[model samples]
Target: MKQTSFTEDQLTDALRALKADTSDERFRLLTSEPPKARIRPLLWYGVAASVAMLIVAASIWQSSWSIHPDTTPTATTATVDENLSQLVGQSIAAQTQAQQQRTLTNDIVSEHLSLVEP
Candidate 1:
């Protein structure tokens, strides 16, 4: 087995070499300026997107309101009431017909059973 250790002088020399390889001036130059030219286009794109969204929202709002113009609620209510009453009358007539059919079926079934029993 072998154990390796760095002495203080060797560690100091390695650190000095590493520090000499890195440049502080390059880092300062990279970070000094805000990227204004790139930022302006992105800002304009965002503004254009918001305006487009507003226009779309306004159109949707206008179309929805325009589709159903202002009319008296009573007229719509009366039409709905007439339709509902017709539906109810048809439903009642169908139920009565079904009841009559059931009664006729019951009578026929009872007559056949009686004849079979006799």
Candidate 2:
């Protein structure tokens, strides 16, 4: 004979036993505690304050900003020429300094090597 897992009667009996022993005790205990009241006044007050703040902020921003015509030259020919001359001068100075540094470094190395030999 093949041994089968829990028979239908056994399963039904176990379920019935569990149902009989279980109670709504925990649910009753939780519900017995006082329910928290919703504060509608505070919510309305916050919304009103936010709307008032936005109105004040918008008025201030509108008062501060104004549309005006451009006054000064954005890209004058003389200004561009001046900028170019300044950049060229800076580049020439940088190159001259770099060359001087290289010559000085080479001289120092040669002097040190000569001292170390014979």
Candidate 3:
């Protein structure tokens, strides 16, 4: 009697048997379950959206203020002048004080140098 090679029908039957195994079914079921969501990317997208919204709102608010020419609420002229004078006076005082300090420092430095040389 001659030993026979497996035919196409026999191969198909074996493949079907393998697929019908309980372990294979469980593995397939487990693998086929929906993938879990990654929290990092989702959180990043949400943060990006919030940042984008804040930027848009800021731009819109800035635009609204700039769009209407009449919306520039006028400052009282007297108050503006007074504030300006005060700031200018403060600046002048600071400059004067700085000059005085520089003069004093120069005198001290010259005195020290003369004393060292003598």
Candidate 4:
């Protein structure tokens, strides 16, 4: 009966003698695509939190501000008005002084230039 198992001599002969085989087809290089990222809930939560904060801030600011203030002028408002008027008067005086100084400087420069030319 022929032996079903391979002997040491048969294995050695198979290993030493090269079996004929041909693969003329060039090797095909394959690249696997990267896995798509899943949307996280944390990002949406952050956006919602920011929107909520903005809404709250806007509501607070709107509630605090008034377009039409109380018409009843108190003593403090009277003083503030007086102070504003004084500030306006002082600024006007300073502007006039600055204009006069500028005119004087220009006159001096023109006189100097005229003397240098002669």
- Best-performing candidate as measured by TM-score: 3
lDDT: worst 10-residue window of model 4: 25-34
Sorted on lDDT, best first, the list reads 1, 3, 2, 4
Q: Write one digit per residue (lDDT tens) for candidate 3, span 1-118.
A: 3326768898788778775546877889877745454667788899999999999999998887787666454656688789999999999999999999999999999999999995
Instruction: Give per-residue CA lDDT, model 4, range 2-117, as digits (tens).
Output: 65577999878878797554444322212333233234566778899999999999997766554435533344767879989999999999999999999999999999999999
Better of 1 and 2 by TM-score: 2
Candidate 1: tens digits of C-alpha lDDT, residues 68-94:
687443467779799899999999999
The lDDT leader among the candidates is 1
lDDT of 1 at 69: 81
Alpha-carbon RMSD to native, per candidate:
18.9, 25.7, 19.2, 21.1
TM-score to true structure, per model: 0.38, 0.38, 0.39, 0.37
Stretches off by above 4 angstroms in model 3 are: 1-74
> Whole-model lDDT, candidate 4?
0.75
Local accuracy by lDDT, each model: 0.84, 0.78, 0.83, 0.75
In candidate 4, the residue pairs with backbone N, CA or C atoms under 3 Å apart (3 or more residues apart, or in different chains) clash, namely none
Candidate 1 regions exceeding 4 Å error are 1-75
Q: Could you give me the TM-score of model 1 versus the true structure?
A: 0.38
Cα displacement (Å) at residue 36, model 3: 80
lDDT (Cα) of model 1: 0.84
Clashes of each: 0, 0, 0, 0
